[model samples]
Target: MLKAILIDDEHDCVELMVRELARNCPQVQVVGRTTSSEEGFRLIQVLQPDLVFLDIEMPRMNGFQLLEKLDTLPFSLIFVTAYNEFAVKAFRFSALDYLLKPIDVVDLQEAVRKAERQHRIDGRQLELLKTQLHSHHLAEKIAVPYQQGIIFLPVNEVIYAESDSNYTKLHATQNRQYLLTRTLREVQEVLEERGFLRVHRQYIINLEHIQKLVKGEGVYLQLSNGVSIPVARQQKDRLLQRFGWL
Candidate 1:
């Protein structure tokens, strides 16, 4: 059985969720429920449930703030919110799950099933999601998944990435280029914090490896490896902004 916790400011809602979990989701056992974020955080540290049904709004500390305080999140989260337009949009964008207020039994059952399936498929997906969520607080490091095995690369080693159809080519200062099966957009999403900039539609260059910018008749980048990359007209302004020139 999956241990779970229900956190909400409304006592009635918390009771309802607990009852629903008991009735609909036999696989989940409610370890605790609370209206206070502080108490909820404490319980989370103690119980270490398999999942948390978190409410986004609460006095003193909100749900997101509670998640922020955790050094290492102990469980997967299914956000429970009444009405927060922006928060809902963010949840969808981040590919996380949430249930709006006036929760339906069907929705609750579906959410629990999805969470269980995710846990069974790859336990590491939860860890990856947590890492992606709190990556800002982590030290700079890159783990590139490969067919042979995972490659641990320091963020500083990557010089640039170029799109090749559905794959991306990673160029590093070690005189080796790696072909990854990830799209350019996915690569951009993961490497945004490591000073990577898209100078063209097909190219993402590491700002640390840029030797100089040649902006004459047509803009081009002078890389540390003596390779010149043509900068697209539309992306030139954004590239300049990346260097704090704008």
Candidate 2:
């Protein structure tokens, strides 16, 4: 069974989830529950639970504040927030689990299922999430979760990404290529803000890695790694404009 704890200022929210966990989730054992952030911090040190269901909105110290206070995070976090805005923020923080207020039994079970699968939380991952949340700088690296472990690739080292049937192939410097289980569309969506541009349906290029642009009936991009990827005719204009070639 997974040892778990709940930290939320909402009395009813904690009570409802506690009851639901007892009724439906036999795999999880709730070790402690707290309505105060400071008390929860002490409980975490004492219990050292496998998982923590943390509420985002609280007086004095919110969820982010409590997370910042910790020197090291050993447990997986499942963020609970009442609004959709915080949900996006949670995702940006690479939160593995997120539950909205008036949590559904199914969502709660799903969150616990993920928690059970994780053996331990990576401290580097927590640090990266914290940096992304607090800093103005673009995220320097993006970690891709794979079957055995995670692949932490420096964003700048990535030359481009190509579609590989259901998977996306990430090509980086030194001729390294990783076939990720996630789709190219998903990868594009995440890194689109960070200089990744989809120049064709099959390819998204790292603007910083472009060596030369070849023009013909269509266009082709030659990456620093010497891979020439074809650019779709429709995207040519957008690409040129983005590169200030137009």
Task: Give the poorly placed runs of model 2, Cα more than 4 Å off.
Answer: 12-29, 64-72, 82-114, 146-152, 163-169, 177-183, 214-219, 244-246
Residue-pair clashes per prediction, in order, are 0, 0
Judge candidate 1 against the unseen true structure and give its global Cα lDDT, from 0 to 1.
0.74
Per-residue lDDT tens digits for candidate 2, residues 1-246, read 888889999999989989999998999899999999998999889999889999877999988788778888878788787765433442543534578788888879877887776655665665666576556444678765555656677888898999999788888888888776556886777768788899999999999998898887767889898889998888878886887783
- Write the residue-wise lDDT of candidate 1 on 1-246 in tens digits: 999988899999999998888888999999999999999999899998889999877999988778778777646678888755444433432435679888988878877876674441222333333454454342344545444433556668888889999788888886868776557886776566567888788999888898987878898898898888888989867875766662
Q: What is the lDDT of residue 160 in candidate 1?
A: 89
CA-lDDT, candidates in order:
0.74, 0.79
Q: What is the lDDT, from 0 to 100, of the residue 231 in candidate 2?
A: 89
**Candidate 1: where are CA atoms >4 Å away?**
84-86, 119-246
Q: After best superposition, candidate 1 residue 28: deviation in angstroms? A: 0.6
